[model samples]
Target: MNKHCCNDMTYHANFKCDIHKDLFECPDKLIFFHERDNDYGLIIHDGGSSSIEILFCPWCGKKL
Candidate 1:
């Protein structure tokens, strides 16, 4: 398996930083939300333990 190291932390994928990169065991059980200054908050929810992809950077809370 391939892994990347950042901030002395090793992860299976890109680990830019704590705020930017992370691994969640039950990602599907969590609801991700993004809010902008004027725009309505964007919410993401997986139906189950299925894989999900996000386009925004969770670290900076910016669109990717």
Candidate 2:
């Protein structure tokens, strides 16, 4: 599934799910590193393991 970010990055501060319209906070970390043309990706911590996967926002239950 194609991942989607919140329309407003600060939505988590208010504890509101952008997609579900419920009280929740997104745990997905925003990646600042850019490769080319302002392309970016999210960083999901995996206990320092080589395995990495883009997880969904637990609050909204949507791909992050």
Candidate 3:
């Protein structure tokens, strides 16, 4: 997996919720990383998996 700009970004991108046990299964998953696209996004929990692409790290302001 590609390294994220910050630890917070990394953690969120690979989030494993204690309740859901998996990022994909978590209803509150916030950040997302697309390996194929090599980009990061903010997850939108609107009943389906959707996200808004983010250019900079929300935690560190680093270019992603």
Candidate 4:
């Protein structure tokens, strides 16, 4: 697991389940962290599997 700015960020980023096919398949997943891009995003549950890149941590206010 990657280190995040705070517990909230870490918790949300690490929350995952094998039962779901992907991030979009899990409705509880609201925050996403892209390992390759090294960025964070707010997951959009619009059935398009799209997300909005976020620059800072919503919980800690730290630059992501």
Question: If ranked by lDDT, best first, what sequence of candidates would result?
Answer: 4, 3, 2, 1
Error of 4 at 44 (Å): 0.3
Best by TM-score: 4
Model 4 ranges off by over 4 Å? none
For model 3, residues 1-64, the per-residue Cα lDDT tens digits are 6578778888888776778754555777898888888888888777676789999998999989
Give lDDT for model 4. Answer: 0.88
Clash count of each predicted structure: 0, 0, 0, 0
True-structure RMSD, every candidate: 11.8, 10.7, 2.7, 1.9
Q: Which stretches of candidate 1 lie over 4 Å from their true place?
A: 1-12, 15-50
| lDDT of every model, 2 decimals | 0.31, 0.36, 0.81, 0.88
**What is the Cα-based TM-score of model 1?**
0.24
Alpha-carbon TM-score of each model against the true structure = 0.24, 0.23, 0.77, 0.85
Residues 1-64 of candidate 2 have per-residue lDDT tens digits of: 4223553423332333356432212344334223243333343445331222335543455554
Better of 2 and 3 by TM-score: 3
Q: What is the per-residue lDDT of model 4 for residues 1-64, given as tens digits with 9 covering 90 to 100?
A: 6578899999899888678878877898989888888888999988878999999999889998
* Alpha-carbon shift of residue 60 in model 3 (angstroms): 0.6
Best by lDDT: 4
Model 2: residues >4 Å from true position, as ranges?
Answer: 1-28, 33-35, 49-64
Model 1: worst 10 consecutive residues (lDDT sum): 2-11
Residue 51, candidate 2: C-alpha displacement in angstroms: 10
